[model samples]
Target: MPAFALEAEQRKWCEELRTLAARELRPLADAGEEGRINRELLAALGELGLLGRLFAPDGRPASALDLCLLRESLAYSCTEAETALALQGLGAGPVALAGTDGQRARWLTEVTAGRAVAAFALSEPGAGSDAAALALDAEPDGKGAGHGWRLTGSKTWISNAPHADVFTVFARTVKGAGSRGVTAFLVPAGRPGLGGEPLEMLSPHPVGTVTFDGVPVTRDDLLGEVDGGFGVAMRTLNLFRPSVGAFATGMAQAALDAAVEHAGTRRAFGGTLRDLQSVSHQLAETATRVEAARLLVYAAAAAYDRGEPDIPRRAAMAKLLATETAQQAVDAAVQIHGAAALQRGHLLEHLYREVRAPRIYEGASEVQRSIIAKELYS
Candidate 1:
């Protein structure tokens, strides 16, 4: 399938997204750049319905192709902003898929309007790759009490914790059952006893630890049913994981762009760098790997758009292969740049750090490999 099959109008929208991002976000990545998701840029996206693009104009579930196209283009220029926007989509996406119409109209509306930021709160200090190992606890509140559920536990390394106005918190239901006992909650941040502490990482993205010390949640916010959260979270990932691949695609594209420019302009051995077989071969290899990765990602995304049966396996494969290839491509770009790209401020070096996070989060490389292997064997 074509990487993207777009009408002229959608093509214009994609161009606008890329052009606006470069004009606005590119400068934020330079010189001690916090790369924070600035308010104005976000509002601009909201104004164009980019923030609210997941839903169709008819107000139903969004087309997968549209989601992928917007995310892939956004990822190319600003990885952090891309991630932030993704968090907004993902945090409320589960409820949209599984929640009552009221839930989507309530939480998702604010998020799409840019009035609130949304986040998914599933990862814990101990449950990095093994999602089933999650240990946060949520028990039914006494019937006489005002609240329906009381959550008590700590979740570490959560994105948007510090800034999130609302979060989709997951917790264990009870001990008797395994996956059945796990439940998901829509918990607002700063609800009395909740706590958030920022985490420092290689990339300058917003991350923090969240703790719920007897946080109250209304029964109305329970996504799906008790223990139904497993499917909710998994299905959500199955849909959004390809965007992680898109982030990888962006890194690879950026790296390849840098390398090609350097190869044509830089001189060695009385010739342009590309004149050498070693450099040319590397260029060819980078190009080939990037195209391969792009195809894999696009195929998986296409499957999602088509409602194919094997989307989980396809998405996992796409996420893993695309990210690894993108990393390799970026590394090659850094190598090709020699010393110039090694500078801390260089785009390749910045992308080198930015790309590493995707491998570790949203289902790690090893985790996806295991999932794919299990699917293949079973």
Candidate 2:
């Protein structure tokens, strides 16, 4: 096999994951209530030992390529399972990367075991793509011997907000410092003054809003250096962005497979759909795009694993291209399937909804373009 291709072991692992997802995870995902945390699915992930793979145990960083492969394989058969795994990594990433040994011992183990749900709370009502502009304030706790801070603000669109056992919350610690003022805190769900409510969304996931009305945090809660949380957040995003692209590519592959299968069987105008030049050409274009996107995703993941300096540009390009391509591929799949694809519970219908959110989250396509352009000039 070429260097770009998956090694035999990697290919076998991916196939096993797909089989596990289809046979075990997909049923739990289907039974899960929309907009709610699927603890059962998470527990299943832990039971299968897959959750432990998200973090390296030897005091080394997790491989970005492994992350991408896991996500893509799980996403190919069970997007809900893939999402549960990714959310755990995203929420606990700061702690896994920068938390104190005590913090790691307290949270990381439980997170890996799926006994504790975690959330990454960075985006606020005013922040979103402008993450540095987050307004959640963490004022010094004057009455707590100056050893703690009181958090007061709201975070919107936080995945696993309402149900997560702990959250890596970002708040402003120094006024007028822009990104430098931010601090990341590990706030437990039962903390006083911390509250959350679920938000209904088109996609089936546990995303919601969190409100912090003077939630108190001590030095122990800090995930990284105070006033330097932005770096931690960026590092996590930089690592995961390409995997997000891989996730999108997996969905694209599934959609392409469905389209190809349908075209080969479904007849139109006295002949099979694949016999038509127009239908065949559309499928061909989508297949080419999906392969290109997958290659870009693989390259970005490999670069990240290698500790390459141009990771930001490569990751942005991978995510932007793959997500946009997934949307197009899924849309084309729907077009070929016609009205049957629109029916509830259809694979194409589910993918149609799932593929759109990736383009918007983990930094939008516009933000990605800006990052790439900046990298090019620098």
For TM-score, the strongest prediction is 2
The ten-residue window of minimal lDDT in model 1 covers: 28-37
Tens-place lDDT per residue, model 1, 22-58, is: 7765554332235343555455567767788866543
Query: Which residue pairs show backbone clashes in model 1?
Result: 173-181
TM-score of each: 0.93, 0.98
Per-model CA lDDT versus the true structure: 0.79, 0.92
**Model 1: per-residue Cα lDDT at residue 333:** 91
Question: Residue-wise lDDT of candidate 2 within 105-154, one digit each (tens)?
Answer: 89888988999999999999999999999999999987654479999999
Q: What is the lDDT of residue 378 in candidate 2?
A: 85
The lDDT of model 2 is 0.92
